[model samples]
Target: MVTRRWWQKLYHRSGSSTAAAASTRTISPIMYEFEHLYQMAMEEIGYAIDSQTSSYYAYDLEDAQAAVQACIQLYNQLPITDKWNPWAEALQQLQTRLDALPLPIN
Candidate 1:
């Protein structure tokens, strides 16, 4: 079995920590609420795709794909104005940790 990198473990650990913290602390209730709304929006998008595919509506499929892509692009564009933009910060930390590891030379 292959071993996972330290950064991978760190990423997972950080996510777990954030989830736990979010659950206990209600400082940003609106942000937490938005998370639930965002999840529901994603689920609706998935349902749209399924409906389009099952109905074999070419236009509907294309529209659904475009909507999903737009949503993803918008998500990627979210500004990380501070050092604690959780997702971006976590990803950057993971990359830094991964890069610090020495690779085995063949």
Candidate 2:
């Protein structure tokens, strides 16, 4: 089950100061949390991409696939925005690379 994040809890809490600050501030807590999570997801995606492309070392396909799946999950949890465009592109590229790999017959 997906649990609510700290920002969600904060946003939902009664009589919260963040609600007021969010309205007046240019960068709301929600945006801050989104950016933080986006950065983390991007980092994980980058690592998987890099490891797969590097010529010096062998990387685990399962691990890279897992990382991509995790990033996709995080992306799905976040709100809709053009900010996610890059992530969508990166995910596509990573998926393409993964798809090129030969599958083992069961």
- Report, for every candidate in turn, its global Cα lDDT versus the true structure: 0.41, 0.50
RMSD of 2: 9.5
Compose the digit string of candidate 2's lDDT tens values, residues 1-106: 1122323432464555545656665764555555444444444445445555554113334444554565566656666753467767876776676666544222
Candidate achieving the largest TM-score: 2
**Compared with the true structure, what per-residue lDDT tens digits does model 1 show for residues 13-96?**
446756786878664544443343334334434544455435434433343334334334444554444224664454444334
Looking at model 1, residue 20 earns an lDDT score of: 86
**Model 1, runs deviating above 4 Å:** 1-27, 54-106
Off by over 4 Å in 2: 1-59, 104-106
Candidate number with greatest lDDT: 2
The count of backbone overlaps in candidate 1 is 0
Which pairs clash (backbone N, Cα, C closer than 3 Å) in model 1?
none
- Per-model TM against the reference: 0.31, 0.41
